[model samples]
Target: MSVLSALGSINWIAVLLAVVAYSALGGVWFAVLFAKPYAASLGRESLPQPAQPALFFGGPAVATLFVVITTATLMAALNIDAAADAVVFALVVGVGYLAANTVIIAINPNMPRPLFYGLISGAYHLVGIVVTALIVVAF
Candidate 1:
């Protein structure tokens, strides 16, 4: 099936749920678990509050939903139904594309600790994709 077909068949509700799940995960994943470390990576004792709080939170939420919408649509297009298939797909995109580029991009910026940024970013991308994929399959 093509992307157009997938869009017709995809369960938007499920995709929305998956987006929320990962978004919540990110909120805790960095904002709480890696709070200090994340701040440290940016060479700051604390992350500064965004001038517009809505943009700060809403921006990522919107991006997350968009990611789910498109990827889940592709999954539907590809007829990704099996657990193994979804896992493999997620791993390929998450690690091969997202994670690898994250390392390179973070390093190129001369980040204080390139590995730290990569690790944090890579973990989120990998886990977020997996969780979203699983939910896409489940619901």
Candidate 2:
């Protein structure tokens, strides 16, 4: 099916749930679970209060929505109706695209501990994708 048709056929409720779950995971992962480690990865004594907190939080929310939407669209296009198939496909995309790109993006001049940061962030995406896949396929 074409991308447009796939988009139309997508379960929007599933997409919304996935986005909320994925974004909430990020909030907990960074803000609660690994706050210290994440700060260390950035070479900060502690998590700094961003001047533009809206961008800090809102950017990821928007990105999470896009990620969930894209994953749902792909699942629809590929006819991944089964939860198992959705999981497998999610793993593939999570590791191949999200994790790899996270690592690459982390390895930048400003990042003090790029590898560590990559591991934390990439793992988040990996799990987020799986959670999203399950929701998308469930509906």
Candidate 3:
């Protein structure tokens, strides 16, 4: 099935709730826990704040889409049927995201602190996991 068709089988309310919760988790993590300190450490004058509501909303929406696609693909490829499989998938994706971010930061030292970026990326992927789990459970 196409990604959209797979996602169409899900309960959107749960999917959205997961996305919002995850996005809020990330926003708080970046904005409060790491934003200023990370920017200062990089000798940056300021971090780029969201100029529009969409900027804040768009990311999680895209992330949710990504999770849906990934989960659907994995479920098909691995024949995943258990909650444990969903959890494992989340962990694997989180690790892969961290590694990718590490490479990106290594290539561009001007990027935010490794720990900060890693945390952000990890949390984002975890959120994706939760969203995927909710979809699988609901469906």
Which candidate comes out best when scored by TM-score? 2
Best by lDDT: 2
**What local distance difference test score does each model get?**
0.85, 0.92, 0.60
Candidate 1 vs. truth: CA RMSD?
2.1
lDDT of 2 by residue, 27-52 (tens): 89998999888888888856565576
| Greater-TM-score candidate between 1 and 2 | 2
lDDT per residue as tens, model 1, 118-138: 898888889999998899988
Q: After superposing candidate 1 on the true structure, give the runs of residues whose Cα lies further than 4 Å from its correct spot.
A: 46-52
Candidate 1 vs 2: which has more lDDT: 2
Worst 10 residues of 3 by lDDT: 98-107
Q: Which stretches of candidate 2 lie over 4 Å from their true place?
A: 46-52
Q: TM-score of each candidate?
A: 0.88, 0.94, 0.60
lDDT of 3 by residue, 1-139 (tens): 5555654555556556656655666667556876776456454637575465775668767765666555655565555567777777766765676446544664465664566555555555566565566565544
* Cα lDDT for residue 44, candidate 3: 63
In candidate 1, how many clashes are counted?
0
Cα shift from native, residue 26, model 2 (Å): 0.7
**Candidate 3 at 132: error in angstroms?**
4.2
Model 2: weakest 10-residue lDDT segment is 45-54
